[model samples]
Target chain A: MPIIVNLDVMMARRKMSLTELSERVGITMANLSILKTGKAKAVRLETLEAICRVLNCQPGDILEFVEE
Target chain B: MNIKSKLAGIIINVSSFVIITGYGYTLYPSGIHNWMYSYKETDSLNLPVSQYEALNDSILTMRNLKNGYGFDHDNGQFAYLGTQTSIACDTCSYTWFKNNTQTYNQNYIKLNAWGIKKELPYKFYVKNKQGYVRKAVPVKNSDSKFNIVDVPVKFRYNTMDDAILIPVSADGASLFDTGWLILWGLNMIGLLFLLYLFIRFSYDTSKGRLFTRKNVTRLKLIAVSVTVYPLSIILLNLLVRFVFRQYFSPEVVLKDMVWYNAYIVLLIGIVLSLLYGAYNRAQLLQEEQDLTV
Candidate 1:
């Protein structure tokens, strides 16, 4: 519940739409929306790797942890 | 995961279906027939009247005295005025006796008694030692004595045994019988429904929907049904006992194996409910994973 996803920030920095990122990373747009909204409970290493490969960003750039 | 689960699910589904169908085919008929005919006694061994008199005396001697419809009998001394309504020593305290007469409105009792008098007359039978009705007594009770009704003789000496006394017509169709059939029929329906739920759950698992909300709900339903199934049976037993206490003695339903089996079912339901909770947690995790992208 504490971890947050920063996918939308990275997508904005890359000048890419969620649809475009989903196409590049081989994930669904709905799933990308979930990541962008910070509602994802967890992220698998492989999926993070794929996302990083597509957007040219580190996993830390797309993920953040906030203490409650 | 999907293929292996599918194979396991298909095997389980087919096995369950076959077992249920096999039980329906091979065992249900005779079992149902035996239960249905529990009220009817056959192959009675005839005993002499003197022996019956002695047997009756011994039974009376062994038991204590209690009030019989408001008549008090002295200890060690008693009388048999007629069937169970007679003022005899209390041998029947082994079970609860419902005073059907006083519980009624006097006017209704009178009306019902009158209607019964006009309709099929009570036939008295002399019971043989083997517990068969040897002869029907021709003399009927005078109309003035409406309370003196003939009690049906019990086939066995043990008065505490449970008997399902369904008041059927000559053709054996009555309200009580119909209701009993319907109640047990619902048990069968519940079993079939449970089977369907099981198959559906297995199918969902095979389709990789094990942690889905739909599968969780299905498991909950199956759990509730399993719990309720035994409870329904216990209730039906109680209902039968309460209704037929006058004509026959019903065993203590809680003393039977059904009660023990019910506890097992309750355990199963609790376990299944927990399983559903676990699946719910898994579903949340799955959602998180799907969204992780």
Candidate 2:
């Protein structure tokens, strides 16, 4: 629960809509929405790698750990 | 049907046939020769005793046979003292009856026996109810008016015999009329349907359809049917007793442990229904997670 996904910020920075990013990343838009809304329980390393490659950002840029 | 369902179906059909056939035999046992004459005569009476001075006092009580037998002329009463245990003798010709009520209660004494004999030293089985049983050997007291008996405790519940048939009564042919048989058949049919539902549920689970809404609803209906089964039987029995108050009593109906066991089954059904509800919610959560990226 402490780990947050910052996929929306990265997507905005790259000027990419969720659908376009989903197409580029070969992942469903619904799943990308889940990642953006921080509802995903965990992200597989393979899925993380794909998202990072498509968005042109490091894993840390998309994922953040905020201490409670 | 798939293999799993096919196997389940075969077992279900075979078992259902067996059970229904067995029920039919019990329902119509008239073909058996002289089976209706198997009733034994038992006389039950409550006698009030006025004197009890010590622990070994020979309590004297008397009852009339005409009042005890009532209208049950067939006289089919019997008691298996200690069914599975050697503690009580099955063939001990000694004429004595065990106290049905605990001796600690001092006012009235209750007992059931075949016949009563008048004598100086009466043989009686003394029991402190629940667990304690002893044989009271009576002897003439010093005053010669009252008898004194020495009772040595024989067995406790822990050491009691395991395989004894307590009291078995055969409801004579006259007792099982057409109406009673019809009611019993209806109850049996309900049970058969319950078994069918159980088989279907098991077949579905074997097919990996455990968390489907169909299964959830099925389980709920099963729960309700089982819960209602015992309740409906008890209600019917109560109604019969009410209508035939002259012939029936609560003691007669409540003696069967099957009624209480049905309630236990009802409780189990209710618990399963609750678990099914929890599983349904978890199933929905899993479905949502499956669709998520």
Top candidate on TM-score is 1
lDDT of 2 by residue, B241-291 (tens): 454345321112233344456669779878877877787796677666664
Reference-based TM-score of each model: 0.45, 0.36
Chain A of candidate 2 scores what in TM-score? Answer: 0.95
Clash pairs, candidate 1, are B45-B130, B47-B129, B162-B250
Q: Write the per-residue lDDT of candidate 1 for residues B196-235, one digit (tens) a residue.
A: 9899999999987888778888888887777676676567
Model 1 global lDDT (CA atoms, 0 to 1): 0.47
Reported per model, the fraction of native interface contacts reproduced equals 0.82, 0.27
Roughly what TM-score does model 1 have, to 2 decimal places? 0.45
Docking class of 2: incorrect
Clashes of each: 3, 12
Per-model lDDT: 0.47, 0.45
